[model samples]
Target: MVTADRRQGRRRADPPPRRRRLPESPPPPPRSARTWTWTWGTLLVVAALAVLLLGRTDVLPLVAQRGAAVVLTTLYGVALAVRTGGRPVISGALCLVLGVAGVALAEPILLSGLVVLTGVVSAVLGVMLTLPAATFPGVVREVLVAVVVAAAGALAIEGYAAEVSRERLAYVVLALSLAGALLLVFRLGAGLHGLGRRGSVILAAGLGAVTVTLAYTEALRRWASPGLLGAFESFVAQVDATLGGVPQPLAILLGFPALAWGVSMRARRRQGWWVCAFGVAATGPLAVALASVGLVTAGFSLLYSLLAGLVVGYGVIRLDQFLTGPRGRRARQLEAASAHRPEPRRTAPVL
Candidate 1:
């Protein structure tokens, strides 16, 4: 039956249908991504601190320390390769095998000798595996130059070692080898040309300082008084205390930010910059650890710090890219879509 109003061409008003209620979803289960990130980050930091503390305690057996060193070196090499866009898993396995072999071969020699041998071998392998294919010829030539220089330097060091007190020979050899390697890299590789005149001068000054400090320390060790040595030790202790008793090896972490920033500035290209950054990060810690242990002289610490600064600088740039890159754009798109979506409307019931 139709209403009289409808017969007269006037429609009856109908009540609006009740709005349907949506079931409330459980609050997004506590963002596991953030949780996992923080958990892993905390664990890694703790592990690093523990390792540094243990190393400084001088309680670990020498063999254990050497093994730890080999493992760390191999890991660093793999990380450097991966960060530079090379094959990571294969590089990691190769690094592990080569590092172990080098360490095993060096075992007949003293710990210091083993350190030098393993370091050199690891460095060579890292360069070979990580460098771009196009640079192979240049790298090969550089390798030849490096080998000749290293051989000559080794002979000189042997002569120097024979003449010096046994205590001083290791330190002297290590310092000279490091300086020589740096010089060869700068002279033969493209690094120096890229650095410009001012950078070159700075590098030269740093090298000079390292050499002078090594010589001065060797001389002092031969003639300095017990009182003077004690005073120096006390000063070092004070500095350590001021730094909250952080082991010197771990001090490298503090300089990461600065290193990444500097590297980004020097290497404008993304791929090149990342490679440079990882290289610096990996090597800088090794340098710092060596210097802290007196295996490398104090002057060389400046160079190591600079390397770390470069690594961290590049890291900063990478972080910026992540925040503004493709992923970031996608996230913005999702936000826009959600914001513009229309709400559901209620419909009137028909009579």
Candidate 2:
């Protein structure tokens, strides 16, 4: 081996280090998938719009109009599933067949005890679809989107104006929504395997709240003495008159807080999925806001409930931050060091 001379122009400068290239992000969904989504989405919107206009003009017969509404709502649910990274063509076709059968057998199913079952299942789906967010504002935005989607679903099912007593249509739409949301969340939550101890507790609590509330309400209606029932009704009426509308207690107490905290937790842990499941208390009621009450009454109730729930949600967030967040004089530094990982966009597939 030849040795270099120490005096040779200060030992020629070392070659510059090769520049390191950061890994590139994964490519977006295929072009064909995007094209299919856009095309299918546009078609659905146009068809739904046409149905709405014709129904308003009374050009479509009542039975046909209701049937069309159910189909459109089912299609909307299929679109929601596609948004969750499903194979659009396959899932859409399968759901369409089920939707047709639903329309044909709606009356028979309605006469059964589908209302309660549909309500609970749809509520669970509503909460799951809300997903998780990285920030408070992000959570709020997601909640708003959930509300808008629920409202659209409600509108799709309200095709029979004269048959005001037919609440079964709403349950059908709820069933469709439940089916779509479940298809994705089942995978996202990693099914039962992912629900560890904490997740199990949260889920149990959520189900308990919903079940107990429903049982209590039904019991009050069916078994309470007339005097007690009248007193309760009077109290509710008085509260409604005084406050313009009474907010749903479930929403204010459980749904909003659980959602806010759950999303915040999801930024840190998967257990957030369990907590988010409780958010259905709010979303489920909001889904049928128009169906359960008059337009004006629904509007007022929703406004009050939303405002109050946000306040409670904010409190829950603060409490969570206080309990689990960084502390001490170096808190800001700790937070900076523990910056959150980036999340996918709202419309993007999270799993």
Candidate 3:
């Protein structure tokens, strides 16, 4: 008859369902993030060194630095807006007026703090807006890392500047060392893309301009007659007061990196134009920071800006050549072939 098994109407209970283990996604390779971190970190370190050199020599005054910070933050916002295809020139102008008014009305310490806070917020917004929508999260993480690194670098520079306040030679040595480091970093970047002879020349010229400008400014400060220096100082002070202490020199200094980046991008045409544009735009903040810290003066800034403009213009011309040169020929051929392609005949539509 029906055995116990038959009575149960079932064989052994189905085995418990196996839990399928998913292969843990390999921790995302951090190459891209690390590269961005290093790039931004190096840039900040270089900026800190510049500030220290300028501040120790009284080139970057507190009032100038404050004004510069506000200006830079505004420029960064404008740059971000431009990159995102939004026209914020009017907004930027309005922000600048408001910043100047705020500076005029607020206490020095309070204004400085407010500017710093605004800079932080602007930096975050700029990064967020500049990144692609598809990869926003990864970009945000990288930007945060960069900000932390840059902040740490700035703090270290400030401490070092204080420590070496009395040591003129120490400042000189430190400036030279930082300059060398920057050169090495840029040389490496150039090397990565195999800069051609023309590229090398452009790079050398840019580096030389930076070096010469720094040396000239330092020399003018150190060796000029006390009468001359005093006259210059008075003039600078007047300018600062007239402009509400917004230093133009730092703005020019900020333009150098942009000019250099544009040259490099032109040297390697495969890179995006937007990247070069962004790099140039990003300098507005650095320029402000330098001004805030007393790393640049009005006269030198104007001179540097002129030189940087020349260099960037040259780079743009070179890039245009590529578009109109042999490469353009190949592109034209492709377009011609596509234009000549025949359309397939379709049967008349049935009524």
Report model 2's TM-score to 2 decimal places: 0.71
RMSD in Å for model 1: 20.6
Candidate 3 on 88-142: residue-level lDDT in tens?
Answer: 6765675567666656675544444344434333333322222211122332333
Which of candidates 1 and 2 reaches a greater TM-score? 2
**Tens digits of lDDT, candidate 2, 10-128:** 45666667999999999977968977876876587567646754765679876665555555555554555555666656755654565456556666444122333233334543454
TM-score of each: 0.38, 0.71, 0.37
Model 3: residues with Cα > 4 Å off, grouped in runs = 1-193, 246-254, 257-351
The candidates, ranked best first by TM-score, are: 2, 1, 3
* Overall local distance difference test of candidate 2: 0.61
Point out where model 2 deviates above 4 Å.
1-29, 32-43, 46-68, 83-87, 98-131, 160-186, 190-197, 328-339
C-alpha-based local distance difference test score of model 3:
0.41
User: Judged by lDDT relative to the true structure, which candidate is superior, 1 or 3?
Assistant: 3
Task: Please report the candidate that would top lDDT against the real structure.
Answer: 2
For residues 1-351, could you state the per-residue lDDT of candidate 1 as single tens digits? Answer: 467668555433555679999999887435576366446633543453344345545775444444555555445445434333455568667756755664566533344543454344333323222222112233233223322222222221221111223444444434543443454344323564566654455455544544565578767767899999899889867865564332322224422332233233222322222222223222323332332333223324434543444344445545644654336657644533343222111110000
- How many steric overlaps are in each model, in order? 13, 0, 4
Please tell me which model should have the higher lDDT, number 2 or number 3: 2
**Which of the predicted structures, 1 or 2, would earn the higher lDDT when compared with the native?**
2
